[model samples]
Target: MTSRESALIDALRMIATHPAARGLADDAAVLPVEAGGLVLTHDMLVEGVHFLPDDPADSVAWKLVAVNMSDLAAKGAMPLGVLTGHGLGRDRDWDSLFVEGLADALRIFNVPLLGGDTVAMPAGAPVTLGLTAIGRAPECGAPSRSGAKAGDDLWVSGPLGDAGAGLAIRQGRMDGGLASLVTAYQRPQPNLPLGQALASLVSAMADVSDGLLIDARRIAEASGCGVAVQMDAVPLSDALMMVRPDSWETRIEATTAGDDYVLLFTAAPDRRQAIEAASSRHGGNARRIGCCTADRGFALSWRGGAVPLPARLGFEHG
Candidate 1:
């Protein structure tokens, strides 16, 4: 394996503190919850993409925590702690700040620290981040994007586009409340408890890292059903509203921009009451943004009517 691949394997081994972590095939490191089920998740950040060229090491570390936590949120996993694989530059200050930011995230989430790794690299290389969080799912079964069902109602925890707009602002687009929006993009709050509350109610679940449109399409494809979204029903941040009065183009990009880190889930038509109850009990917001249809294709409601969507896609790494 390449050095990076070897690093990944070594990092996995370090975090594999649980029995299930033996194979390391699962996305997160799963472990028994002590009282009951299981919990696990992973978060990865790439330089120049997830962060700025001059991004602070601490901030990058915070993002490392947030992204992984977001995954656990989709699975309804409670924070246990984290294992980190951080790329180090020649500067020791950067490494310290990175750990500090990670510590900040741990404090906010009330999680503990597990062991991790540090490796030196040639200077000026792009910084990279990887974290795997262990947690408690209570029942061992966390939700997956693949479990969505036809005729189910789709919901998102909060507004969309803020994270994307944050990136735009950082990249010098329109700028207002850049801090909050950028913070959203930077330190996403994973809705872990809320996800657990939704466990029995949601048929399928996923974190909206990729834009809602793309993420929803993933769920649809996984469930072998088509999804229809009400463009008007999508949530928006106050910052988004200020800059995007003509939100038409913004909506399209935001719907596809990746890195929102909110939950997108599906519920049965008959389970609306269950959903409402779940939201109330869990203390999170969830709106019926759209529905899973028998159409066998993804569609979106534009200004006047529903239009068929081309193949749903996201950022290309290559």
Candidate 2:
């Protein structure tokens, strides 16, 4: 290996203190499986696509880790460790900052750095980073997206659109003043505790990464049911509402903006009280915004009137 690669590995060894990591000297991690089961998730971030070039290296590293943890949260699983695939770019200082950020994130999430691979990229190429998160599923079992049934109520762990608005602000498409919105975009907090509390109560669960509408429709299609969302009932943070007008258009934009990592779930109508209690106990503001229907397609309604579906639902790679 080159001196540069070896130096990077040595820096990583400081954070990878987990026994399974083997001090980053071994080719692979040796992890022990939990009795419940293992939950595995992988996510990637690209320089120009997933984040802006001017974004801080530390925030980028946090995003790479948090996004994967969000998947684990949806499964009601406790994180065990993480494996990262880092692309070494021309910016050496940026790489150093990313290592620092990774260490901070691992500590915050109580996850260990196991083992991973690093490779040098061509000069001037966009940097790419990948992470694989390992988690232990809840004893009750991890809820699947296809578990939703007709008559179930759809819920979200928190308000939507903050991250989307933050992106717009970052891109200069909108006015900037709300640092909270910007932080929401830069550092999203996965609702791990809420997910764990609601695992047994939810019929289906998934993180709102792509977009709420698209992710909900995924559940509908997977479960062989239809979902009708009430746009008026969709939750919006005070910060988002203050920045954008509270209208049907704004609601639609928020739902389709993507990058919101809150949990979107479904539960029986009868479980409303239990769900509410769980959410409250976990310090979450869960809101019911829709319901599963016997029909076979997704639909939307605004203030009791049927609204047409948008041309674009969420982000997707071509």
Candidate 3:
């Protein structure tokens, strides 16, 4: 009789009694293990919903692994291996490309393929893929999304909205020649090293799988605080700017667009120097776009004026 949210709460109450669950507030579950801890997370992607039916099978396979690895990055855990659930397609070429793409992702991320299962779906059914990523938590412990404190500065690992633009291209809403945007959508790099550097430094952290505003609001709700983002501070790829004009509307669209697997985290203002240094050391880009507030909601500001929130924050499954 319980709703999905309520059912999740009840299940957590029953199964997350152990201290290692991290109260189920993080992207991955942290369980105590020898010498340190283990971080486990699983993510699923479906055809037509997560990708265009004609999209490249290799890219789809890469996304399936990258998205799961992004969750591991959020936990500040180093990826050890992955288990894949592959739904065999009728097309032999597509399946072969998918394997190649899977191999590419595993090699790029330096993760091993532990094992997995494959099953043939019914004729005309959509393909569904799943990945389970296992990681080892750092000595300081994995970062949680519920640790942001008031006055902490919010930062993002890199630019946003390119993937959204890439999607628009794939949908034929835009002209061609923007291969960077297309590639951004197809191959997203998870900031694993930056996450490890922030494990002990940041108060809270998460990967930007959803819209930036929505993900920020999630952290705010979890930490029981408010967050105000400065629209001007959001980084945008040059490719996106060339396609879309600069304006508040464009900024809003960029922030609310999804599919960017960048890390969003909060750190003390005093740690600004250290954070920047860590980002540089990890060969990652970071920008401070907001700050945590004592209030209990999310806010947006630009040029000393408030920007109204959009009706839809980002891609919604349901």
Candidate 4:
């Protein structure tokens, strides 16, 4: 290994205190799964795509970790540890800051840094980072996207559109002032406790990483059912509404803009009270915004009237 690579591993060794990490000397991490099933998730972030070039290195690191953790949260799993693949580029200082941020994120999530590999990037290549989060599935079992049944009520764990607005602000498409919205885009908090609590209650669940509309459509397609979204009932943060006028257009924009890390789930109509209680107990603002229908595709309604589906639903890699 190069001196820089060796130094980076030395820095990582400080945070990889988990017994499975083997002091970062081994090629792979050794994790012991005694009883329950393990939930594995991998997520990646790229410069200029997932984040802006001017975005703070620390926040980028945090996003890299949180996105993977969000996947675990969707599975209603408790995080075990994380393995990261960091592409080394020209910015050494930025890399150091990222290490610091990774340390913070690992601590905040109470997850340890396992073993991972690092590679030098080609000149002028964008910085790409990947993280694999390992979590223990809930005893009730990890909820799947295809588990939703006909007549189930659709729910969201928190407000939407804040991160999209933040991105707009960052891109100069919108005026700035809402620090909260900017922060939302920079750092997303995965609601693990809420996910865990709702594990047994939810019929289907997924985190809203792409856009709410697209992700919900995924659930519908997976479950072989139709998802009817009540556009007017879609939850928007007061901060988002304050920045952009609340309107049908705005709501549509918010739902399709993507980057909201909230959980979108479905449960039986009879389980509404139980779902609400579970969410409330975990400090989540779960809102019912739609329902699963017997039909075969996605539909949207606003103010009790049919609304045309947007041309774009959410972000897609290809």
lDDT of 2 at 106: 96
TM-score of each: 0.84, 0.98, 0.88, 0.98
Off by over 4 Å in 2: none
Q: Where is model 2 poorest over a 10-residue stretch in terms of lDDT?
A: 1-10
User: RMSD of each candidate?
Assistant: 5.7, 1.2, 9.6, 1.1
Q: Which ranges in model 1 have alpha carbons more than 4 Å from their true place?
A: 1-37, 280-283, 308-313
lDDT of each: 0.75, 0.92, 0.83, 0.91
Candidate 4 lDDT tens digits, 115-208: 8998888989998889999999999999999999989999999999999999999999999648999999999998999999999999999999
**How does model 2 score by TM-score?**
0.98
lDDT of 2 by residue, 151-200 (tens): 99999999999999999999999985589998889999897888899999
> What lDDT would candidate 3 get against the real structure?
0.83
Cα misplacement distance, residue 105 of candidate 4 (Å): 0.6
RMSD of 3: 9.6
TM-score leaderboard ranking: 4, 2, 3, 1
By the lDDT metric, which is better: model 2 or model 3?
Answer: 2
Candidate 1 global TM-score = 0.84
